[model samples]
Target chain A: MPENSVICLKNIHKSFGDLKVLKGIDLQAHEHDVISIIGSSGSGKSTFLRCINLLETPTEGEIWITGEKLKLARNKKGDLDASDPRQLAAMRARVGFVFQNFNLWPHKTLLENIIEGPTQVLGKSKDEAIAYAEQLLRRVGLEERKDFYPSQISGGQQQRVAITRTLAMDPQLILFDEPTSALDPELVGEVLGVMRDLAGEGRTMLIVTHEMQFAREVSNKVMFLHQGQVEEFGHPDQVFGNPTSERCREFISSVY
Target chain B: MFDLKGFGDQLLAGTMVTIELALASLVVGLCLAILAATARLSDNWFARNIALAYTSVIRGIPELLTVLIIYFGSATAIMAVARLFGYDEYIEISPFVAGVIALGLTFGAYASEVFRGAIIAIPKGQREAGLTIGMSPLKIFWRITLPQVWRLALPGLGNLFLVLLKDTALISVVGLHDLMRKTTEAVSYSKEPFLFYSAAAFIYLALTILTMVFIHFMEKRNSRWGDK
Candidate 1:
């Protein structure tokens, strides 16, 4: 626990009926800490990221965002739920999420999609939100395509817009769940480029990614999960170059 | 030698009534359908069962029977309620009002199923995207789910509307002077069954064509995003 910690999760556990996906995972991200979560498929990388914002509610955990603890209560089905819905919503508003699938609303144009969170949840005026959205769209090199529907754009362009949409909320932390996993091989670079810029800006980000090279290069800290547990977590060089865990070393070799 | 000199105005008036009835019922039915579909998809067991029972009972019986029951039953039911209030006067339910209720209830039941299917056709990711962005569940439905559902449900709803237009003829049995009822009166009075009946058929056909054109325009409007 550091004084500047932005998000802290302790003993996070998630289960689906009889199957446990995440078991006793702990992570504390400070401001400007870019952490990359890397593991093989079914290793709970995405689930661990989703639990931070309560997307997939953890079975048992204490999550604190910017030092504010999230309150949870057991419902009739014995599944945990937010005791105060408004608190959950307010907390979620401050934590941005980028899905693996672009998941852009097809009905709205690129600019409209980017401004949705700012106008709808943040209660910014339409003119102000639109101006901010235009700026974000310009930064992503999508200024000209602001009026295009998501279906009209390339997968890489859509993912960039999705990132811009998250960024528009001015969140304290951003969680990317394999943001480029669904893009084509050639389209991956465009999305990675945008993420690289975000990382360079010193934003706190937790990314679940299969891009080993990009993850190794951009992230200051690398977390390797194996069999629903944190097998190795440390500086990228130590974990990637000389991981103590045998399983993590094997995974690194297989992916590389 | 078709001569509809005396009954032409009566037929015209009846066509207006039919159109008015159809439009009113469409509005009522659409509102009810949205409510029922949402209830049917909700987590509350009571709401689900109530919506299910409404759709099931209304859909299982004939539309004609529904019209008859609503026309006759409502008057009796109102009288009983009035008696309970210590006011005993015979109250009559207008045929137009009864017809609207019966037709709207029937249309709502059928349209609810159409809406439910449309809602399910949307990807789960769309709603999840809204949730992560911090929109309330109601906001998600209004902004994200309802817009997509409306687009998806348009063609299906158009077909139901054509059927609803034709079903308005059933309202004539309850003594409302709709197209069918007017035609019947003209036929018996003039003994020109072929001419007057053919005229009524033409009017109904014209109305259906107009409705189809309107629905096509609506479909085009909804596809402004290019059906992607």
Candidate 2:
């Protein structure tokens, strides 16, 4: 692993029952790198991103994030678990995750969702967390709706709030699992806009998306995932424009 | 056609006793339900099987039989334990405490199912969200999970609560002077089974109506003024 690399996944393999989803995939991301992974529904894009944080633990693999190589042990249930829970927790803290459903904790208000991680996990003072939350809400253009519950907000607004909530942890790496996939066509643009702004700020992000245009425009690197492996990966211009692999071309054409 | 002037105070006191018994039993039952549900959901084989056994045993028996067994069984155990200590005297277990234990055990079994369903209703992502933010498992459960579980479980628990309240009448068989027992005494003296029984039914109905109103208000408060 490179000294400056923010995340490195070595020979990651994941299976569920008889179905092997991710087949010996490896991934690496550095600081300020915005990598977009595009693939079909079952191509394991989301699974790859989830494996980075051990959310869906890779059946067998080595995961290194934020300078720590995590240890994996087969638990009694026959599934992999982190050998050192404390180490995994610290690693998770550095990796912010945005889910597909924009799970903003339905009972809590938008402001509360933003401050939860900062106050509870980061040990920030209430006043300080609230202050930072307000700024993040403003950045996402949801400041006026901060007091509203998740159910009361529009899908677009909720997704933006989800983004800010993940950002509140001040994670060095951010993993986005189909962030806009659940949004309506009209709502997708607003969420993508917030993400585009985050990319402009040079945040290190790993996004699994179906948006071809967003992948081509906002990301510096684009990876075409096919059957749980990176079929093609390089600069966006080469992957999307030049197209060396047949499967990558087929996928690009299918989406376009 | 009922003459309430003579037995009104006694009936009112009986109603109060009934409410107190039900409330205490429900509180105990809630604690047991949380424990049983956690055990059922535990990853360990022993804990899960033990919780399953508890629910199966308690739920399989009739409520009246459970009351009798807990009452008489506890009394015997207490007396035997006392004799072992060189104190040769019968130990009396209060009907109230016995009733609480028996009724609470029955209620707890039903409650475990309610809580399990509520916990399942919550989205899996909520816990994952907490974990990704570095919140400990204990913190995640108390903060992210329990509040949602309470909201989801309230209606079901409230439904069972009504049934459990009515079941308190069964405790009168063990000699607790609840509403049913008081009404039986009043009927025996007056020779008007119809009148006293009607009064008893009215008291239960009135208590149930009041409870439903309070539960409705609580539902609204917990909903934050609107449905999700």
After superposing candidate 1, which stretches have Cα over 4 Å from the reference?
B1-3
* Structural similarity to truth (TM-score) of each candidate: 0.97, 0.95
Report the alpha-carbon TM-score of model 1 versus the true structure. Answer: 0.97
lDDT at position A8, candidate 1: 93
Error of 1 at A34 (Å): 0.6
Candidate 2 structure lDDT? 0.89
Best of the candidates, lDDT: 1
Instruction: Mark the regions of model 2 whose C-alpha exceeds 4 Å error after superposition.
Output: B1-3, B225-228
Error of 1 at A182 (Å): 0.8
Which residue pairs of candidate 2 clash?
none
Worst 10 residues of 2 chain B by lDDT: B1-10
Q: Across residues B173-197, which tens digit of lDDT does each residue of candidate 1 receive?
A: 9899999999999989989899998
Task: Enumerate the candidates' DockQ scores in order.
Answer: 0.71, 0.61
